[model samples]
Target: MALLDRLRTREATVGIIGLGYVGLPLAVAAAKAGYSVIGFDVDASKVERLYARESYIEAVSPDDLAQTDHLCAWTVDFEQIATCDVVVICVPTPLNQHREPDLSFVEDTARQIAAHVTPETLVVLESTTWPGTTEEVLKPILAQSGHALGRDIFVGFSPEREDPGNATYRTQTIPKIIAGDGEAAQALMEAFYGAVVETVVTVPTPTVAEAVKITENIFRSVNIALVNELKLIYDEMGIDVWEVIDGAATKPFGYMPFYPGPGLGGHCIPIDPFYLTWRARKFDVPTRFIELAGEINTNMPAHIVHRTREVLDRAQGRGLNGAKLLLVGVAYKKNVSDMRESPAMRLMQLFEEAGAEVSFIDPHVPQIPQMREYGIFEGRAALDPGRISDAGFDAVVIATDHDAVDYAALLELGCPIIDTRNAMAKRGLPMDLVTKA
Candidate 1:
């Protein structure tokens, strides 16, 4: 189809699978661009919520529903997508028990699409995955309908660039990188997404687009590990690592600062790089840097636990058991409630195993659900200084530096604090009472 055909007809119905942080916003964007959109998800509750104009995702706006105005609807039925002009999949690609890429969600989506796929409909995989997944894994399954690609049906890959809770960027502003199996497929994808997004760049092939996404995340993982490693080194010399980082970042040309914390968290930064490394192994290529970065990032939570143990040992040789520990935040990042693969949960589990009673407090997240490890501990219901001061916690661990939290008031609580995020330094707390890791 010509670009003009899409612009004039407006018959381009967009079907988005997985009504999540990525899919919901993208569907809203497409609907705002004058295309009818249908969103499908396995979770019926999420589909029901979208119909009621209730957004569980932080990136979507309340005005988005009003602006779209009956242009979009969500469904759990897979058959409804058969009428769509374009389809996009944006599900989570989480790690399994052994830390391997779990592609079951992707496989399930492909099987569903295969049943409803028809000629001339464009299918785009927006979920982050290993290179060649679009052409190798998804294509074979989707072709089960006996439709040939580039002629009978079209397929492409476009990785989602979603920054949840970011004030400056949104789905419409972020540039999209897309590629397809052939020229016709590329044109269809570009036309489909270009109407919703401001800028769309076409790469050589779908594999290149996949690699671009992985490289962007791997760069972040590697730099974060570098800073976390340096924090430990600088701490031994009694030099404030946060101060040193701020000083070094003053140089305009050479430095891009990545801060240190208890450990890496969030769904993408901690897991996306491993998808590439796992696939690279089949090609007989060892990604040493990726492996080393993963090693450093994964070890950070345990290192923080070890440092906490040392701090307690110095106080009175009191083990983690029988110690009251307060984790400052449960969310992976500041101000966002996404807890998928959060390191704070891992730290809590490790602390509980060592006999410490762990609890957390976050204004955004009023409750932290109990896992099998940490049985049942309610988050401190209030951030009042009096409440914190009266609480009998032996130590406090700063995990997330949410703007709503008053670190000054927390310091007034008088409990010794383990400043994992350097939040105490940002609040100008005295070094006598704060220990940074």
Candidate 2:
């Protein structure tokens, strides 16, 4: 069957499972591309919000929702997905306590799909997983339906190319990397995605597609960690690492700009790389570089806390105990309101334990309820610069540097500051008031 023919007939209901950062955007794109889309999730509240056009993801605008509403519906029910022609799994693939790939979510999702597998439907795995996960782990469970691949139904893999908060490339603009088990499967999958995404790049097999996705994320993890390590070394040398990076960035060749920060956060950078490293060991290969990068990134919060302690000592006899500290931002990245795996939570707890009262200010996130790291204080509304300056804080930590923060107001506050994001120097805040780490 021709890929376009299936799409045109409306026989292909594009069902996106686990509508979070990845699935929501994909569902929006597919529905906009004229496919009937059923966005399924286990979260009932999320389903209700999507139906009302209340978006959780920053990139998925109300305009996207309005355009797709005619053909789209959100549900917590698995039975809704039974009628789908193409099922794309975009569930979370997090690591366990031992830093091993937690495949329980993926396995469970696959089992649900297996129960509904039909000869005409196409199943594609979009969650970021270890290489060989699709064929080795998913395929067998899916085949439990007594249907053979290529003959009975179609199976493929397309890693979700979701860049949350990226202004340039969105779900449809970013080219998709796809691979299928066989010729027929590849054709069906390519046509399905080509309708929504701008370009579709096909690899030889599913494993190659998996490897490509991990490599892209791991490269980011390593480079960010390298700059983070440099941030520490340069701090001890009394040189501003942020300034150094700006100067080095003038070289057009052999350099890519990566800023240092408190630590790695978000769904992809810190978590996805470890999935690859964990799987590589099964093949008797040790991913030393990837592991080292993760280690440096993970240790950054502790280092930031230590720097804050030093600043407290320099200021007064006050330890972090009862010292008023303001965390500038809580989101993992600037301009986005996602706090998953954010290091700011760790820093907040560290300061509170040392007897410091911590409050956060981010335009993106007004109030952060006490999370796992700290459970005592309820978050306040947007930070008032006038009140904060007058409040006599012992020190300020710029954990997440949101663009909305008034840089000049912070510099004029006349309080000692420990900057992990290099935002103070970048905004040309007074050198005397700023301390780097």
Candidate 3:
């Protein structure tokens, strides 16, 4: 009741760890809702940028950061978490080289929070992971603080549904799903998140909350893989996938359109589904759909490469082995700077391996930053009409269809193009110059 009173009266200080895409928006929303927010991160540069009211994420603007400056403080010190009344862990749960769940970030953040967690302090994890993670992995680590759960301290799991660059739904509008270890914890968390978001869904257990997020992403992964497979089949049957999808969408009763792309990209769709597959192995359950979806999605980049070679050979009687190509839009999705698990990286590597010189142009990303697995492409080519006219490339691959691109200009160049995203079709470009891959 004390915690609930503090949260209601706007006297509670909210602490959010890992000030990236998910955490930063949450911190801002909490601050805007009249709570003092402390954003914690290990990166010194990101912390420094936050203090200066600079936002690196596309969803959070610099104006939003400046407005929250009075109520928000960005820090790198873990001890400052002790001053917070509630702490939320929004860390990344990336997969390892073996495509298994890697909970190192979440585990490390829980250990840090345990060191400073006090009696009556509410702690919630917003990182997406497999079921039983909250109970099996985090609870034991947090118990080291010696404060009994639901009696002295409270804990919950609330999966983040942050969609970057989404104009329709902001952090406050998206319905949050929350589950707690006990009734006390559930009540406190529901009250806390309810203050910021428009709607709150309370599940029975923490594992169910974790499974909800995984299920949402798995549905997308499998559906996207289905569309990609259909795209290949329809292409072989001399049919346009975009036209077929449009006609099917007109039915409107039992259909939701999921477009096919070069491959799966972004932090969530490409990685989160596999966490379930890894956990299912322990329970002796076979996740055939998940494994098959992963296989199809993983092979998309190679398929795009093969289509590019065929397009080049059919158009100009030249092979991709010695040709020069330009890749348009290197980011994972449209109108965002995030490049995690982007298919463009794989396409670039495939082009280079086949002895072709590749250059990229992305309006959102002027220069490609350093990535964990992908090598950095040093020079960024200009996307202007003059440059496209001057640089004689064998073909152009529309990997990501950002709105800022000049689709008409690319078509006017009269060059062979592999339109993996159907941007050319959307722009009413002629089929003669554009090959729908």
Instruction: Evaluate residue 379 in candidate 2 and report its C-alpha lDDT on the 0 to 100 scale.
Output: 62
Report RMSD for candidate 2: 2.0
Judged by lDDT against the true structure, how good is candidate 3?
A: 0.90
Of candidate 2, the 10-residue stretch with the lowest lDDT total is 369-378
Worst 10 residues of 3 by lDDT: 376-385
So what's the TM-score on candidate 2? 0.95
Model 1: CA > 4 A from native: 2-4, 7-9, 369-386
lDDT tens readout by residue for model 3, 1-437:
89889988889999999998899999999998999999999999999998888899988889999898999999999999889889999999999999999999999999998898888899999999999999999999999988897887788999999987789999999999999889989888888998989999999999999999999999999999999999999999999988999999999699999999999988898999899999999999999999999899999999999999998888889888889898999899998988888999899998989989887778888877777677556354445545877788889999999998888888777789899999988887677888888
User: Across residues 390-422, which tens digit of lDDT does each residue of candidate 2 receive?
Assistant: 777778899988898987777676777888877
Where model 3 places Cα greater than 4 Å from the true spot, the runs are: 378-386
| C-alpha-based local distance difference test score of model 2 | 0.85
lDDT of each: 0.84, 0.85, 0.90
Residue 374 shift from truth in candidate 1, angstroms: 8.3
Model 1, position 274, has a per-residue lDDT of 90
Off by over 4 Å in 2: 2-4, 8-11, 369-386
- Highest lDDT scorer: 3
TM-score of 3: 0.98
For 170-286, candidate 1 gives per-residue lDDT tens digits of 999999999978898887877788888999988999999999999999999999999988988988888887888899999999789899887788779999999988998899999
